[model samples]
Target: MSIGKKLANKTETVRGAAKKYLGRATGNTRLRTEGRLEQAKGNTKQAGAKAKDIFKR
Candidate 1:
């Protein structure tokens, strides 16, 4: 897990949040679900990367 992956995960999380809100405001269920999934994926990636870093130490 390199810094790039971590950064990407963080960025994805933020983007996902924005998308979620946008979806909510528009009442678009599909967008909302997509955003939620993206958020989860980002969180998972970040956690995995952190775990890898910890093990590396």
Candidate 2:
């Protein structure tokens, strides 16, 4: 993956993790779920990028 894309994905994952922990600490179930979904989205995008890179080779 390109540098920008990799950085964006990593940022998303980190942001989601922060949100998840914050929500848990604050007792916000909705926020926690949103964070989990966001993390999953970031992971899925990263996986797709890796697949594309592999195919390009």
Candidate 3:
């Protein structure tokens, strides 16, 4: 994966974790669900980047 994409994915994952924690603390189901979705999005992006790298090779 490109460095920029890697960094962005990591940031997303971290932000998701933070949001999930905040949601849990505040008893907000919607925020917690959003956090889970964000984390999944980050993972999907990372997977796509890896696939691109493999195909480039």
Candidate 4:
């Protein structure tokens, strides 16, 4: 995968984790769920990037 894509994917995952932690600390279920969703999205994007890289090989 490209460095840019990897960096973006990692940023999303890290942001999501931070949000999840914040939500948990604040007792906000919605925020926590959103954070989980964001993390999933990041994971999906990373997977797609990897697949694209493989195909380009």
User: What does candidate 1's lDDT look like per residue over 1-57, in tens digits?
Assistant: 777878999999988888898899999988988899899889998998888889999
Best by TM-score: 2
The better candidate by lDDT, 1 or 4, is 4
Give me the displacement of residue 20 in model 2, in angstroms. Answer: 0.7
Could you tell me the lDDT of residue 31 within candidate 4? Answer: 94
Off by over 4 Å in 3: none
Ten consecutive residues with minimal summed lDDT in candidate 3? 13-22
CA-lDDT, candidates in order: 0.89, 0.89, 0.88, 0.90
Task: Report the candidate with higher lDDT, 3 versus 4.
Answer: 4
Off by over 4 Å in 1: none
Q: Report the lDDT tens digits of candidate 4 across residue range 1-57.
A: 779889999899889888888899999999998899898889899889989989999
Tens-digit lDDT track of model 2 for 1-57: 789999899789888888899899999999898889888888888999999999999
Q: Over the full model, what C-alpha lDDT does candidate 4 score relative to the true structure?
A: 0.90
Per-residue lDDT of model 3, residues 1-57, tens digit only: 669879999899888888888899999999998888898888888888888989998
